[model samples]
Target: MHLREVRSNQFKLLLIALLIILCMALAYRLLIVRKNLKIAQQADELQEQKSHLLEQQMALDSLSRQLKVAQQDNQEELRQKQSEYNQKAQEVELLKQQYIQQRQYLLRESTIYKKIQKSVSTPNPDHKELLTDKDWKAIYKCIDTMYPSLSERLVLAGITPTEKKYCYLSFFQLDSKLEAFLLNVNIDTPYKNRTRIRQKLKITGSEEKLYEHLALWG
Candidate 1:
């Protein structure tokens, strides 16, 4: 009986030892599962953070490219405006030069015209002695028949009689005024032909002096 009692107590101790070992194994397996789950969750969170950072980096790069493009456009626009301004300035300078040349040309033309007018309008003293009575009567008759309206004008100018030498008729223009009349009692033909006489009589005072002489004689 003593031996049996000892065996029974040993059996009870062994069973308790086995139960403790089993419980320890189960606790270790549960702890291992919980650790693996925590590691997986941390890995997922890290991946999400990496994706967000990458998206932010891409957005910043796009914005930088746009800024560069805008700056380049502004620079090109400024250059174009500067070029236009320079072209206008050159045109203005050219116009000013043209105006100056035109003004100078006009002044030169005006001076030449004034000199021509002065030369044509001056009277000759030598032509006064060539008139005569017969010449006057012939000129008066011719004027009355050809240009009656000029009689008053001719009378207003001075005319005198002298010895008759020759008789003639001529048509002439003086300062754009036309004269058609008979010229009487001249020593020599002052002009060789009709064209020459016309050209000579174009002298400014010739028409006025001739009219005056004819009026005095009449």
Candidate 2:
């Protein structure tokens, strides 16, 4: 009976050992599966982070392009404004020149302007008398062009150089402002016929004077 009880206790111990081995194998498999699951979760998180980083990089690139475009537009606008400003400045300068010219013309038209004018009756050592047949022709051309109304009424009488700077031109008397000087000269007249009426004229453009004329004719 003792031998039988010993055999029975040995069988129970063997069964208990197999049960312990089975429990140990199952715990090891559970631990391996949990570790694998944790690794998969970590990989998924890394993938999501990579995707987010790519999106941010794309957004930054787009913003950089937009900023460049805006800067270019601003520079173009500034150039256009500068061009307009330059054009306006030129226009203002032109207007100022015109105003000054008009003012000078008005001042010269006054009778007191003659007192301040330099006389051209005196001779000049630097220049010779600009008198020649060609000059007379030029004078006639000027008269016909500038004084068309008086061209038909008058003819070239005589041209005598009063000085190197002044010339005397005689014309038939007319019922006009004889006191005022007539300086538009045109000697290239087709009319070579001489007139009995005579007039002397002295005209000046040099001698630091604006154009002036004095008629010493009846």
Candidate 3:
């Protein structure tokens, strides 16, 4: 009976030991599974963060490229405008030079014209002289060649019926108070030819002094 009791107790203790070891093994397996699950979750979160960072970097690079293109376009426009301004400035300078040269030439011609008129005219004349048809023709030709701008304004240029020594040069005025005015010029010079009379011809008016006249034969 004693040996039988001891065998029974030993069997009970072995069964308890086996039960404890099985419970311990189950707990350890649960802990390892939870750890592995947590590690997997962390890896998923890290991948998500890397994807977000990559999207932000791509956006930044696209914006940088757009900015560079915009800057290049603006710079190109600025260069084109600067080139146009330089070309306009050069054109204005050329026109200024031409104007200066034209002014000087007009001034020199005016001085020479006045001197020739004073030298050719006689102070007083004794006899009444009438201009011949040939003389009138030559005078008209000389005036047309010398004063084209004045000729453009001229309506009529002929010997005055009332005054034979003087000619009535009717002109149409533009942008002036008077619409038209007649200018009187002496044409009684000894010089008969167009070349000689061209140097002596003088035109004078109450509104404007046009040219010098020839008055030797009046």
**Residue 178, model 1, lDDT:** 14
lDDT at residue 147 of model 2 (Cα atoms): 27
Q: What does candidate 2's lDDT look like per residue over 179-203, in tens digits?
A: 1222223332211211112222222
What is candidate 1's lDDT per residue for 1-218, written digit by digit as tens? 99999999999999999999999999999988886576446445534544454465565555555555555678776565555555555655565455434333332333233333343455534444333465446444433433334445433432112111111222222222211112221423333333343333343444354333332232
Candidate 1 has what TM-score? 0.32
- Report per-prediction Cα RMSD to one decimal: 57.2, 48.3, 50.3
Name the regions of candidate 2 deviating beyond 4 angstroms.
74-218
Deviation (Å) of 163 in candidate 1: 99
C-alpha TM-scores of all predictions? 0.32, 0.33, 0.32
In order, what lDDT does every prediction score? 0.42, 0.40, 0.41
Model 1, runs deviating above 4 Å: 73-218
The list of candidate 3 runs beyond 4 A from truth reads: 73-218
Candidate 3, residues 1-218, lDDT tens digits: the string is: 99999999999999999999999999999988886576456445534544454465565555555555555678776565555555555655565455434333332333233332342343324333323355445444433333334333322333234322122221111111111111112342211222232333433343432232321111
Predict model 3's lDDT versus the native.
0.41
Q: After superposition, how far is residue 171 of candidate 3 from its true place, in Å?
A: 99
Clashing pairs in 1: 132-162, 157-212, 158-212, 159-213, 166-185
